[model samples]
Target: MDYQLDKSCVYVQDPGPYSEGILDCENIKVEQNTYFAEVSGDEKYLAVYDAYFRLLRDTNPNLSLVKTNESIHDTISIYSAGFDYTGTSKVTTKRAIQYGKEEQANVTLYCSRQEGRIKIYVNIPLEMRFADLGYRYNGSRISTAYVGGSVKAGLYKCSDGTFQTTDGRLSTSLNAAQVIRDGKTYTASAAYEREGTNDILRVKGFYRNEMFLFCTPADFLAQGDIFRMYELESQSEYLMHNGGDRGSQEDSLTAFRYSEPGVFGACHDGSYIVPVRGPLNRFEALTVRVMYYVPGKEAVYYIYAKYVAAPHEIEALCAIDISDTTTAEEKANTITLQTGQTARLEAPPSDSWQAFSKWEVRSGSDLVKLSSNSGTAVTVTALKAGTAQIQAETSYPYTYEDPLTHAERRNWTTDYKTYTLRITSAESGGSSAAPKKGTTLKKGSISYKVTKAKSAVEFAKAPGTAASVSVPDTVKINGITYKVTSIAANALKGNRKVTKVTIGKNVTSIGKNAFNGCKELSKVTLGTGVKKIAASAFQMCPKLKNITVKSTKLTSVGKNAFKGIHTAAKIKVPAKKLKAYKKLLKGKGQGKKVKIVK
Candidate 1:
């Protein structure tokens, strides 16, 4: 037997498996000049006491030994002895015989003032199995048993004295009670035994972080705040119960035993039935160390079970902005877009932890063109007549640390918003309804196009009714005045309501089919500025009529311009211009049926 000290601990080695058993079970006392090993019948068990006796037994010949009446503050049996060696300074000491049941024994020689602290020399019997000071459990957390961080959960064969693999991917077959519900014990797994042997540690509960660790206790009935038992499967590696499984599967420790110092895996692995909410994060950390005792070799092996807790809760939130000449009501309301028109959409401002991720055309993709699916802002073009809805989404990263600097940062949340768009065709609004530029308006029985600059106004389509009409010289719009230019094509076609017509003074010329099919027309008046007339401008006007031309500069007239007019209609002209009017009318095939009268 031998004894040594390092830091605060004392290590003792007892080399023996003798033919005979020694060390009496009954308690024994100590005295001066009397050795503990000589009386105990085995020197190995009392070697540390003998060494202490040799050093101080002679120095304190006058020292007297007294037995203590107080019981040892431990579960193991013990015999306590006190000694007083007061030469120059006050010296006091205590000797203890810590008795272990079949497998272990200890002898301690303690000093009251050694290196300004109490110290002890420990002696123990060592055979085949390994041992330590034993486990210390508490509600706050558990301290690791091994001095080094190496092994986690793995398998070992006692018969062959060999170890299988120390890998993060591990599986176990065991049947054990894992949860405590309403103060009653519950089994967490349907199957909890390997080869009909309970190979798992039945835990009171288990706790874990999203990707950090899975933790429980070494004892079968140890209690925790999360689950009854957690059997870590190789694939998911999450806690399991009879009901279901919970928590994330990602982890940093890929192997049970790593070449690197800190990497570790769970001790046992298997499929688990966990809760939907998964393991609860306590926002703290704890340690659990599992021990395997080999009785044949009298050896004990241990590894660390480290885990981290997650924060209590988390939430994501999103909004959209449109750009154009829209009123507040229009902006809030559904957007109305003409086919072939495009609109701009903007996202809300981005915050440090919150930012826009992308845009999506949730519906009506065929009617609109999204500039791109991903951006803080995008442009949508109306492609066809249809309705489309758009959505904006956000992103929140899981990691809290900055990627570049590795500094801690605030956690993030996400949100989303949506908008609707309506596209319309030109036919629904009438001719020039969807003009890219210019203003189209419906007034009375006609629709007209006024240029952006208000330079001129032209009839865009045939009038809706044929009532007697008169074109104005100028039209006022938005504080701007525009000249009434040439009449648009088919402006007055197929109208029976008109009995008389008068052209505005600013009107330059008549368009084709401008007055076609005006069967009720009886009289016509032209402005002095009229220069040319288009084909079929007055064709099919069957009413007998009097045609008056105020413009002496009329240069050309189109074919059938006056067809179906009264056969004996009188073409009125200014005085002394009868001969010139006759020539202009002759070209329109009105030379024989009409007479120029001034």
Candidate 2:
């Protein structure tokens, strides 16, 4: 009997009394070389290897061997190779020495095609972890190509230290098509053809995104592959275990499995692949954990790989969002900022799971830099007419529970949010900071009248459905910044949409009935410069439950300043001035019925 084998297909021939030579369906000639030199020692391992490579060649016939090499380590040898350059398609291969090892021998392979397609092969217990990948690309385009391995991965947005589901999870069996996100349709993946019709895989549509792909043997897709995809928008992170317990089921919220780091590599007996698309500058670090188990001979191994992008393809981004109004989604909106003017940038509010830990200016010329940056807010000065990007890094603690085993796990993950700033020239017709005849601040459905008083500007009234208002420290008019000194009587009276207010630091007084009858008002933060609270300033604010005063300059609190306010309303003042504030409040017959805290 005789045998013939090649990269695409394998054939067996009978000599003399047994068989005849055979040609493959693809019309490719076969040679007498073992499919994979690493696992050819044992019939069992060879059979597995042959089957795997056959599937790969069949799935995409463009793959061809490029080169192969070996590395000797004391008692063990590591064999490595790469597929022949076929236009844009390239594959990287790795196999551990299996001569005397009783454990399941395996090979790991990674491949990339020009069209943004990634494929990988992982055999046995080897696993790879990508600590950090992808760079920031927003409001601009950056094209990159990678050759080596294929993988099916999900594109996620970094949110508050956890990865949120931007695009749904992807699978190995999926074809290039559109993916759905947040009820919106988006381009998931596309195929690119090179000059000579070479196919490359690329993620075509979407704004700022990073992908995670796991390469596995074709059989794993049908044999309950350990690689799992999850929609973790509501979760900070997930926990998974590799104990061979396939039927395990548990409430992700109640219990969590053992999770090592960011994400676990697909562990099996084949090739594992990862193809990264989107903004990626350098491979800060790639860690692989190889867990070998052979009954009485269990062992563990690790491998690290570092790769960087070509200088021309590298970019540093400042992740920032800008808005002209005040709302929950303020930081996510895009606004036209006036040249030579300044805009305030803020991170999302804190919650039980995550918070914006800090802000940084990743990259920008003099046209964009941090005027003042802190975790809560930053003041950005638009030096000229151009676009600037800022990044808000958040910290979040990941908690998971495995219901089946009632296992609990905790981890920390850092998240990055990209904010886009479009700086238009002050001469531009759409400048957001250009002085207007009537400087009205519109938020949501309602609009507030910002009128010029004798010495400064004041909020006159709430006329629309706007729900939140942020009084700026100064209003620019003809290039002059005018301080906002007061909230005129009836400023926001009877406005159902008004909910929260951030008084400007330049404010000095709240006239009588200033915010009276604002039934929906619940939270207010008074600036430190406030010197007096006129009579009935906040009277009839039935829903005003909290007042945070950052001022120590309070001179007087007019009678009934907060009378008829919500009974549960709590007054919070600076610790050092708490006693003085309380005394002033009581002396003016304004307190004795409210809660005060330092």
Candidate 3:
């Protein structure tokens, strides 16, 4: 029978004398006397048919099928034709074809209507070309293009000859875009494009539905037509599992030395590993860009990973004490210090696991100066009359197992204590509640006048016969102790027998002519509280040569306070106040030959 097949329809021609007519190929069974013929078209198509030519299922309209009664056979010849390719290229298939031509290939199969329908898949060999490569992560399309620029491959053939998508899962040769774990799937979340290299694609997201971050170059080709698989992990996990493995170690070292800052190494499967370095003492968040080299492309690509480390727990105790006066209880929270006085702060661990870390001045830094911030103890010198807050920190290492994952994790805990420092001027005797000026009273040979009633005293007079007059800082009179604050005018003036004089710490000034005309006086020691020397306080003391002034608060020196003193005399002052003292004593003191030393 001579019949022309339409391009859009399939024609069945049965060889049986009684069955010489067109039949629906979908319902027909592969009986003992049927043969199939398919026509080629410019566009490719797929179709399925029953064992006989009775049931015809047209899947695509671009191709046509014709069954001719050319031979009598129990097997049906399924034809998939019209594959466009270059003539020089070769085509091969796993199943041998009963007949082959330049433009078509066919495979023979045996089936019947009782055995169910038969599916013929057209396997066409096409050139592999990557127009644009990108990925999908965390159920989101991170890149602009799907594998090979949207090749339309969501359908996969099952072993039963039926096409399915495996429950909506994407089926493609580029499996790097999707990750399946614990019965769930995750796709790439984001994409980063390197400048000037649009061909190189990078994607990042959680790997295997875990918190571990995964990033890598998305340009690669699998070995075969089947889907390619890859294993991804974090740098810490890689190190912990393969630290001693020779090949892995070599790769790690090479990557560590040559790769960019945070890049670890490329895994054997081509995915790059990043690190989550932890055991941190404080909360930290950071993003790191990793650079990797592609040997085949001779180019570099970049990927980014983010890390967040949580802080752990530590205990510390620190105390600040006025090194000389404050008691232990008073030192715990607050202490008072006079200008120029020092306090020792000690930070000891509350537990054996803790140790001291550092010390810092949280506020009022100008009020105090520290010897050193590190170590268990630091000496702080009161700089001025102000309040300061000093802080000390301590830390210890801690390890615990994660409850859910049962993984041992390590971290650090830190604790700090801040102590308040109340600083007062040394001239004020480091007290705010000092007594007010009151009536004068006699205490032994030296008469005392209350500068601050009951709390302070001044030297009113001294015995002229006393060779070495020592001014006490405080003297008890009528059962009350007081700070000796000053030397009254003419208190010991013209005392020839007084060859040496020592000023008390609380003394703020020397009255005018306090020791004038004392020819025998040679050496004098001034206290730290001394602020002023009245006019002619030590005038005409010809023998006065050794002078030690310890007061850094000196503000005034009266005219001729040291005039006519020994020409070879040397005046020593606080090192830091030397220049000011020199300028202050320029025209008021000993001869120009007198050397002022610190």
* Cα RMSD for candidates in order: 37.7, 23.0, 35.9
> Clashes in candidate 3: how many?
24
lDDT tens per residue, model 2, 276-320: 221221332233222121222211111222334311111110111
Among the numbered candidates, top lDDT falls to: 3
* Cα RMSD of predicted structure 1: 37.7
- Candidate 3 lDDT tens digits, 127-199: 2111111111111212222122112323444465322233444321221234332334455432222211111
Candidate 2 achieves a global lDDT of 0.42
What candidate 3 gets wrong by more than 4 Å, as runs, is: 1-438
Q: Model 2: runs farther than 4 Å from truth?
A: 1-455, 477-479, 587-593
| Clash count of each predicted structure | 34, 58, 24
Per-candidate Cα lDDT values, in order, are 0.43, 0.42, 0.48
Q: In model 3, how large is the Cα lDDT of residue 181?
A: 29
Better of 2 and 3 by TM-score: 3
Cα error, candidate 1, residue 41 (Å): 99
Which ten residues in a row are the worst by lDDT in model 1?
Answer: 314-323
Count of clashing pairs, candidate 2: 58
